[model samples]
Target: MKPAVRTGNHYITGDVACAEGAIAAGCRFFGAYPITPATEVAEHMAERLPDVGGTFIQMEDEIAAMASILGAAWTGVKTMTATSGPGFSLMMENLGLGVCTETPCVIVNVQRTGPSTGLPTQTGQGDMMQARWGSHGDYELIAIAPSSPQDCFYHTILAFNLSEKYRVPVLVMADEIVGHMSEKVVIPDAREITLVSRPRPKGRKDRFRLYQPGPDGVAPMPAIGEGYNVHVTGLTHDERGYPVMTPEAQEEMMTRLKGKIRNNLDDIIRTEEYRMEDADIVIVSYGISVRTGLTAVDEARRLGYKVGLFRLITVWPFPEERIHAIAARVKGLITVEINLGQVHYEVERCAHGQAATYLVGDAGGKIIHPDKVVSLIQEVFQP
Candidate 1:
């Protein structure tokens, strides 16, 4: 593995690199429950937090873990928590709270297989849809998928910045493969990294409204004991942050929550297009599946196929527009994933009859192989 080069140093493994990135990004609060694949993230944070004057707490359960991080964030601290699928499920209620309250925090879901306890120690991108709608309400979430250890470090910092900027819970949707994979990650110097601080409340403390919009849709957050008696709730509220049951207030609040993400879609959406220009086939994949899909593209091209790869770095807010554009040009779209075709549907929807969409997936505790993906591409092009 090559050394990870960032600001000035290198590191190994995505989990450790993520911890170092968070520390460097000024993340001082971590609350989590230990689970396989993601447990290392919590462990690393536990060992490193004290040295950097940060706080790391192991909560009773994933629910508590989720809640604790939000509470800590309310204290004006940039906070985060890590969990696997089951633990992520446990955190959904609080996750909804973070959404409605518009709290800024990062939740790292290092995914493993399962409807329940499917594959504890294995990797899967099964949680892609859950990251968007798991909270059981209408909300928009920022989800980032990292394909390599180095990206894990950088995207983790980006995740924190987006969470603070949008005042929404940003999900760093990592998987067992990327989380455990050891690779070179460049650690940039602390001073060089651009860190975003939460917008603070200004103007008269007596007249301050917690939900009042700033220049951007995000409201300035004043922490507890900041001399501003700001009230926050899940219920639809006015600028004063008091609950308002009126339809107008409800509509206004919900639109802002959803629109804030949509309005800034360009800044939040990110993807990598490989050999897309003048290509006949495009493989859309993410997380560890993308690594295999990339190799498959190369193998297909070697066989004289005009194959390309589209890697989604930011999973949610779904990159629909870009996929739609590419779908029109490609001869066919193949989606290779670790599940029984979740993202495959997205590809089909975006293709909109422009191209054929194919699914190559594995749901039985192993990754879809590159050869299988290559074979699928060949089969699609067959006469």
Candidate 2:
């Protein structure tokens, strides 16, 4: 069997790095259908998983791929899958199922430009909003954006840890640029890596309540064959995991589903600030756009504009409070993304008139240029 953690510096693509990250995080099952940009992730897993006594299956479709992982996750092992735009859409129903059942797993969406097969080989940050809201229901899940190959490696591990800890599916939102880009990634020793497993149910097996939350608003989980009477479904269920068709049951289920994430905002939300100690304008971005924002911030500084960059590492949960705080102090906020205005609207909504909000974005198919971002910075604030 191969080592779970390869434990060395190796030059690799972000897609391959992500596969390694999942393996290092003790992910034993990977079920996916190959798609452009994200194919390498599954390919790597297929070649490596069996060496570690893990399972890798190429499912018939994205829907089945997502369902396969959710089923595997319930078996008390870490599981994951990878896909791009259209496949992501195909998986939405099961994604909602994962949220409803509180299944712990990871889904990597290496995005390409799309409404429908727009650009299979290029990069786009167009799926940011979809990652948060594509699933139809009142639910909340963690979604993180990785900016580079190194980020992809570490962030995939982070995704697994957060998924297990929170008992909800976590997303690694990568664009084609980051997924295909090659760079140096350091995989830490197995002993040095921290892994989290879902909290197991304790006490009398006969009286177990599958959906009863602990003090932290998260329920302890048990595998199907652990001899616990576990009942799981997508319907509105009570603490016992039995379907309860009532307003109260729905409210109770929804509250717990959303509360776990909302109540722990401080832990779930993460952002990186660059040169914002004193600045009049702040550029807000995530994924590949952060790379553009970084360069633009430096150029804006050289041009004598007090500009900074606010990079969203955890894109969901939205980082509203931090962005609001920045908006209160800055004269304006510029959002750089590959979509016309998905996350840009969130930034604008958070600004709340405290500062003017602008968007430097494209329809897709390419990364936003640093020059465009710098120009927007200049337009938002004069010398």
Candidate 3:
């Protein structure tokens, strides 16, 4: 049977919509653990995976969950796992393992207030930086932020496609409020959804050159049972996938790992510009802050201020080139998020002194009111 994709519109939470999106993306394996504000994703997958001939296993812990998904992906199956702050942290070690082995997978982090279980049911964007740097080393990966139930449904598919396209783990950064908030989610028919498959290796096993990248830089992935001489290790390896510990070997291995994604920056970076054609200040934001960011832009316009919105749909890869060009044109750039300036630092670096940069941060319990965001605009733009 085809993946049990829920066709048409329905009232659902972001978590449920994400699970449905995964099914539509042709995910045939899921290794999950129950965590607050994110368990709904696993619960929905458990109910639906088997219906679509997919396997759903509830792991003992986040580490094992992360490991199980990576193992499943090696069998040429699309896989995913869902978790929150604490669990996301626990999976970091294995996350690196996935990256080093170039295992394609999707990891969803339904963020809740944290720094060690700060608040179980509250929302927060504290993990934004962690998502980029958490797993350690210098590997580049893709991560997307969804602001609503609809976006969670949409971007989860994009996350899977990108993971397969790049042969690395991709992240869906959702939050407590968005995850649990019920809203209208329009899931299209399975046939209408465009799914991308991982590139498959071809040629004789000895001549395959397992690590040899294709024209697009991503190497073709081969299944374990295939007759290919496949050997994958976390240590530095050559094109044949054999372990090579010398510094030269490490450089060659690391270069391909980072270069493949970095070389295709044009294809990886994605953003949204709202009413930004002519504006003096652009409010840069992603995730849940987007709700208030748009409100602030609207109110600022009402007050006769030249304000616009620059939303970061693909949170990682940072969209530096776009910001670099915009920074020169705008008088200033304001970054708003539910944490103390995590993405703010990225905006500031991209500004490069051409535009003044400001941060409108939240401590992460309740949503930041639009009034407060507009207050910052008035304070900054006013004489």
lDDT score at residue 25, model 3, on the 0-100 scale: 90
294-351: candidate 3 lDDT, tens digit per residue: 9889889999888999999999988998899999999989998989889999999999
State which candidate, 1 or 2, has the greater TM-score: 2
Better of 2 and 3 by TM-score: 2
* Ranking of all candidate structures by their lDDT, best first: 2, 3, 1
Per-residue lDDT of model 2, residues 100-155, tens digit only = 99999999999999989987769998888889999997789999999999999889
- Ten-residue segment with the worst summed lDDT in candidate 1? 1-10
Error of 3 at 137 (Å): 1.3
lDDT of 3: 0.91
Residue 351 lDDT in candidate 1? 93
For model 1, the stretches where C-alpha displacement exceeds 4 angstroms are 1-11
Enumerate clash totals for all models, in the order shown: 12, 0, 0
Candidate 3 collision pairs: none
- Each candidate's TM vs. the true structure? 0.96, 0.99, 0.98
Q: Candidate 3 versus the native: TM-score?
A: 0.98
